[model samples]
Target chain A: MKIRTCKYFAKQSVKSIWRNKVMSLASIGSVMAALLVIGIFLILVLNVDYLAAKLESQVEIKVHLVDGLSDTIIGEIRKEIKGLSGVKDCVFVSKDKALKDFSESLGENSYLLEGLEGDNPLSDSFVVTLEDPRLAPQVTLAIKAMSNIENVVYGKEELEKLLDVTYFLRVGSLVIVAILLLISVFIISNTIKLTVYARRREIGIMKYIGATDWFVRGPFFLEGVLLGLIGSIISIGLLATGYYYIARYVEQQMFGLLVISLMPFQEVLKSLTVSLLAFGVVIGSLGSMISIRKFLKV
Target chain B: MIELVNVSKTFSDGHKALKNINIKIDNGEFVFLVGPSGAGKSTLIKLLLKEIDPDQGNIIINGKDVTKLKRREIPYLRRNIGVVFQDFRLLQEKTVYENVAFAMEVVEASPKEIRRQVPIILSLVGLSKKSNLYPSQLSGGEQQRVSLARAIVNGPSILIADEPTGNLDPDTAWEVMKSLNEINHRGTTVLMATHAKDIVDAMRKRVIAIENGTIARDDKKGGYGI
Candidate 1:
């Protein structure tokens, strides 16, 4: 590009938007709406994933030792559980300790079991927390096969359901976001197409006077980019301001109850601003090119 | 200078437009391409502008083979040539100044150049007082004049007007023709295609008449004679 001419065309593009005020405004409005939807969804997805991951990290599995388990055999099980890939922490709970836990869990029935814990009716067990809950089932099954492990209790159904939900959340969010992004692109492009249709005569005149493809296209494409950039900025601002009240309310209402942290302002800001700006500029230009291409053939 | 050598064009529906046509126009000459309807005049002009390509032939402009010019380079070639269509072709949304300034902007003229050149060109087309007027606010003659100003403002080495007077009254048509003649006198090669007998005869410039897409007559100082 001849820098001066490129700048001139850039300025003209900006002017064209103002000159065709109604259409330009419509285009900007549609793009902003599209990007806003996308930006909000992106932030929501990121926060949900963060929260699910935090909760998943705290769940654990219990492995019961076999009847008549030897001290050396118990040591071996500890070494084996500790060596398991995702095992974050492993501790052997003695049979007496297990009985005490059972009794305590019984509440009013604890009195009925008061003398039983000394007899150690409960078998020894290992408390195992894995780095990832999704991997817990496979590792727990392996521990159940060990010589000293008689039974395993990790709420298998519950763990599976939690992992399935996380997988679904991650996959479903991505698919929905992808579909919405495609919709956003279509909306942005169609809006630009309408603007181009309105300016068809101007394009013909421009070509008749010797403007090259890029020259003729520069202003419209720049208009697309400018619209996109501005739309992104607008959406980011709205999202940031809106989410502030939402996060504040959520934090206050569920202060001590929430198992996961509320989304931070910075993370939301990053997702909102980055995605919208990218959506605006890239989609805007592509839309402009598709719209203007038919006329530019002249 | 523009030259066509054995250029032929056939539409996809199998309609032949230009057939083995050959013509040469020197720099600074004002010439009319005259013919009846279906005589290939508009097709020939479209070919020259690279809006349509010849199926079998070469087009040389300033000694370069325009047929071989890249798709992107077609508009660059246009910069050295100005075209005024029969439709007036003024950008309806912009003021007269904006419409005229658009030409320079597409080619990326500096703000300084735009500021200096646009007013002069608009004035040359008798539109100085109406710089802020849109095409909707102007008469048919005035709109065509704006298109003229836009075409010529860059001072192209060649100017092409394809039936510029097609929709004007005699007086307005004469005014548009007069603008073309003045630009021609300034040494820009002028190639105009018209079926208007009165305007053609009145100008008394070299005339190339076509029949069935081939040049039938090339008259020095011709007067709309077939």
Candidate 2:
């Protein structure tokens, strides 16, 4: 294709869009709407997965020592827990240190623990962080089987529920995105079919006058791509604005909880914009190709 | 040159549009295809254009078996043949000049060449003055002339006209016929399918009359025979 011919086809595509303004707008609107929903779900799933991962990494199984255990036996227990499979690290918190940390956490109520410091009731334990939080049950069982350990605590029920929610979110988002993509393609293609149907006589005339199938298809294909691009851009714009305001509201409501922070707009925007643009182009072109295939048989 | 040897077309609905049809038209010859309604003339034109494939036998144009041509190769074959339709299928949105230029553009002709050839073709069809007018702004005869200019703009070796003047008044029909005669005289083989008896009888061209999906008569300087 020569540069001149490309320009001609581009001009023709723009003219066609202008000529069929109603259908063009409808296509763009539907595509944008679908993309917006997909974008929202994508952001939601990503943020939920991120927060789940943060909470999972914070999970640590505490192995409590039996009362009156010797210093050497305590050291042996710490070494055993550290060597356990899935254990990323084992930090030994002595009874005195646990008592002091708990007192500090109480802030103004530190005096309540002042008299108990001499007879620290808190147990000296190994705070064992696992490589994967999902292995909490297995790791907890291993620690419990060790000698000189009284009990293990890792918030088992809460961790299981968190993992389940993340799993569901990942699968659910994928299904929703897939269905939305299909709907976008269906809507875009039908809109293009209307355009092709309207100009079927023109296509027949072109066929009779020796226009190649590509020649007949070029303008329509270009038109479809343009529609997709416009739709995606609009959707991205809407998504960005919507995400910014929602993130701001969430931040305001949960100011101290940085662990559940929404993804930074700049980072999400960069990747989201690129993927949406590519999706738009693919859907648009595919729709145009399918709609015009039957007409080009001439 | 075109040759149809034992070509046949039967619709899936069990209607035989053409059967055992044999035709050969040499270079630069003008031929008229005369027939009544449902007499298979349109099917024959379609076969020649390769719009629909033949159920049996081969259609050879310029030494290439058109029936065996690949999907991509059909366009090249069509480029060698220009077609004019009964309704004068002009793009109502385009001006006469753009309509003619579009034919050349489809085949990827250069801008310089299109600018040079479109005007000359429009002049040949005697529509130079109305080159900027849309099809609706022109008379029926003028629209047909614009369609003719578009058809021949690519300098096709064969011009296939299917009822070029079907909707025109007798006087306008003659004007359209005169333009076709001029094109034929300039060495383009012309194959016209028509129901106009007076024009066929007066012109006295070689006539291939079809009836019941078969060639009933093939005559040199033949009149329209009902």
| TM-score winner | 2
User: A1-298, model 2: which lDDT tens digit per residue?
Assistant: 8897799789978887888888888878877887887787778767766666677778889888888888888888888878888899999898999999888877789998889977888898888898888899899988888777889999777656877876887788778777877777777677777778887887887777777778888988998899999999999999998888988898898766444688878877886798889888987888787777744555
- TM-score for chain B of all predictions: 0.96, 0.98
Model 1: DockQ vs. true structure: 0.64
Backbone clashes in model 2, listed as residue pairs: none
The CAPRI class of candidate 2 is medium
lDDT digits (tens) for residues B127-226 of candidate 2: 9999999999999999999999998999999999999889999999999999999999999999999999999999989999999899999998999997
- List model 1 lDDT by residue over B4-73, tens digit each: 9999999998888889998989999999999898889989888888878899999999988988989878
lDDT of each: 0.80, 0.87
Summing lDDT over every window of 10 consecutive residues in candidate 1 chain A, give the lowest-scoring window: A180-189
Residue A235 Cα positional deviation in candidate 2, in Å, after optimal superposition: 2.5
